[model samples]
Each structure stands twice: as C-alpha cells, then as structure tokens.
Target: MTAPRVDYDRIRDVGPDRAASEWLLRCGARVRYCGQQKWTQDYNNLPTGPLDRYKIQAIDATDSCIMSLGLAHMEGLEHVEKITLSKCHYIEDSCLKRLSQLEKLQKSLLEMEIIACGNVTDTGILALQHFRNLRYLFLSDLPGIKDKENLAHLLKVALPSLELKLNLK
Candidate 1:
C-alpha cells in the first residue's frame, strides 16, 4: 500500500499538536501529550478539551505504518522530546532526514529509539546529527547498518554528550 497522505488543511484548522496527534493515531501509533500521564492509542477516542491544549511530547510508532511522507505532521510540534520507531516497515532514510530537518524537534527532542526498522541504513542514522540536543539514542535490530563503528563515532563527535547504544548485527 502507499504511504498515508498528509492533510495540510487539518493542520491549519486544529493546530500542529492536535493535527499531528490525529495523524499518528490514524497510523496506529501512540502519542503522549505534554502533561498527560497516559498514552493515547485509540484514534476514535482522542482526548477532547481545548484545541491547543494537548501538545505532543512523545510518540511510539512501533509496528505502525508511519512513513517518510507522514513525518510532515511534525513540522510545528515544539514540545516533542522522545520518539520510538520500532518495526515500522515503511520508515526509511528519508524519514530520518525529514525528522532531522525539523527545527523545533532538533531543539526539543532529547531521546529516540530506532529498532527493527530494516529499511534504515547508516545514512539515515547519520542524519540524526542535526539533533544537537538529543541526549540518548538507542539503535537495535537494524541489519541495514553496515558501518556501525564509524556511524557511532561520527555521532559522538557531532553530539559529544549523547548516550548511544547499538545492538545491530
């Protein structure tokens, strides 16, 4: 199947955080709002209060259908601190590139995990260098990564204080 299409008009109507939350949920991912304790997983039962009340702080896209094109929903998100991309078959190098280019995410994102995404290669992981404020990165089960040592070293050089863990084959 093709990747999910982004709705720019929805983003304009509901604001970035809510729009992104809807997109992520529709793609079978879970999202945590800035002050909410529970993860919102059900698209039909999305939290309702204020249009701008819920700010997306974390995303768990494990085994979801999230793709590179859908990452555009994150453009205006300013409070996203953590993201987990595990076993997302549609995720690829372009997804990482798109994520790294998000100026707001680059400053707010502190932790990320990429696991079991077969399409992600060293080129994609390397794109994370733009997240200068990222403090922790976990990578595992990504067989496409060929130069693990060099990629780790480069990331270390780019983000001196980052904590990186790799369990690649």
Candidate 2:
C-alpha cells in the first residue's frame, strides 16, 4: 500500500503519542493489532518488527509539535531509513538515547538531520555512532555540543570507514 500523505492538522488535536500512532497508521502501517491508544501503552503496544511489510523509508518531523519523550513511541517504526528532526528544540540527549535503540537503522539509515536542536550534546552525537550506514548527517546550532573539534575527531574515530557527509557548524 502507498503511504498516506501526512496531514498535521488532522492529528493536531491529539497528544504527541497519539500523533505518532496516527502517523504510523495513516502511512499504511500493517500490524497484527492496532487500536487508538495502543501506541501510548507499554509491552504489548510497541511493534517488535517493521510497522508494515514494506519499510517506512523516511520521516520528517522537523519542527513538529512534539517533545523529546514522544520519540519513544516511534521506536516501533523499526524500518525507518531516514529521519529529520531539524529545529525540534525540545529534543535532547534523552531523545537521542531513545533513537539509539533502533538497531535496525544501524545499516539502513542513510541520512539524518538534527540541526538547530538546542539540547543535543556530545552524548547524543556519540549515540549516533550506531548508524553505521549513515552517509549524511546534519548537526548545526546545537548549544549542548560546544566542542566542534573534539566532536569531529570523535566522529572520525567512531565512523572511520563510512564516507559520511557531515554538516556540523
């Protein structure tokens, strides 16, 4: 099934968790069981595998009305190949920690943009070392990540072989 077009207004009334769930469902996510509040709950709620037979290749939640913890709900979207979180000021180290758990993205994720997120620090940037297949990464205007030189060095040591195009400023 072709993914449905994202309609922010259609999900504006709900909480972030609900918005994420609505996104998955509307994107033609195929799962065994899915209910209104399933993505909000625990254990049984989160899908262990891909949301659909075909992977959700990309998601751009740039400046979306959602907080850091909201990322937890997206963990179930196991096959995401690219994500853009640019200008989402509320996203911090914790959100990156949550993203690091997406082991499937380690080899599939090709690009990621987290620019202008004020709270992302070295800890968060380090967490991204897991994305071994990442060919492009954008990180700019992050206050928590103060030492650019160190960060560049770290990324080099961490992702030596990958020809990553970095946009860090």
Candidate 3:
C-alpha cells in the first residue's frame, strides 16, 4: 500500500523528492534544483550550511508534474529567474496557460526549457509569446509539433531577441 501524501512540513524534513521539492518551493524555502539523477535524495539537510541562507532563484522540475502542482505553487515566487521543465511528456497547452498567470515569470524569468514536452502544441507556443523579456528558450524532441514553419514564425515575431535552441522532431 502507498503511504499518505505528506503536507508541507514533512516534505521539508524528507527533502528532494518531487513532492518535497514542490512543497519547499511553495513555502518560499529557496531550495536549489539539483538535476534529475539526484532528485529523490534527502540533500536539503547537508552539513555544509543552514538551509535558510540560500534564496531560491531557479527551479528545474524536469520530468516532474509542473503542469499541475509546480505551476500552481510557483506563481508567488517573484524571485524565480529560471525554470526547466524538460522531458515532461504529458505537459500540454494547459501548462502554458498556467504559466501565463505567473506575473513573476513574465517579469523576472529570463530562461525557460520545455524540452520533450511532446504534447505541447502551437497554442502553448502562443502562450509563451507573452513573456516579452524572455531571453532564452529551449524546445527539443517534441513530436507533436507538426507545423514547424508557423511555430518558427511565431517565435520570431513574439520573441524577436530570444536565443532559441529548437529540436522539434
């Protein structure tokens, strides 16, 4: 049987699972985003220093449920400057819709990566067009994006100065 889903405090104590990371971030704990390989470990309690000293400026929720809980919880973090939601195969237009609500993302976010989000479509790209100041965007391995020409045109117009790394196959 599965254990009960812990609330915010238990999540902080455990540290670094998707749920725990999301929980800490929501509480303004400023947890750093380690890459996917070490994501499930309890790294928040390291002996290096006190956790409260670090302010979270970035989040890499790669292959995690950013379309749902991540987007919902991140709306309040005005300090978040970068986010990577790569390899989230099920993410779709709805994820972008949620991102639009994050005024923080529109203002402070400089980089975003949505690689391999195969379900994301042109509508999602349109939604991203709103981040006018976004400097860098990376999209790759998206099989569902068929209209490459339109997508490219839209990106050019929407993010005129954006540096893009696209591999939409």
Q: Which is the leading candidate under TM-score? A: 1
How does each model score on TM-score?
0.96, 0.64, 0.69
Model 2 pairs whose backbones collide? none
lDDT of each: 0.94, 0.61, 0.63
Rank by lDDT, descending? Answer: 1, 3, 2
Evaluate model 1: give its TM-score.
0.96
Look at candidate 3 and tell me the lDDT of residue 43.
42
Candidate 1, overall lDDT? Answer: 0.94
Give lDDT tens digits, candidate 1, residues 1-169.
Answer: 9745789999999999999998899889999998889999999888888898889999999989988878889999999999999999999999999999999999999999999999999999999999999999999999999999999999999999999999987
Residue 16 of model 3: what lDDT?
27
Better of 2 and 3 by lDDT: 3
Q: Rank the candidates by TM-score, best first.
A: 1, 3, 2
Per-residue lDDT of candidate 2, residues 1-169 (tens digit): 9634445554454433345555544333322232222222232354444334333456665665445544445544545566777777667887787777766656667777777888889899888888877777777677787777787788778877644444555
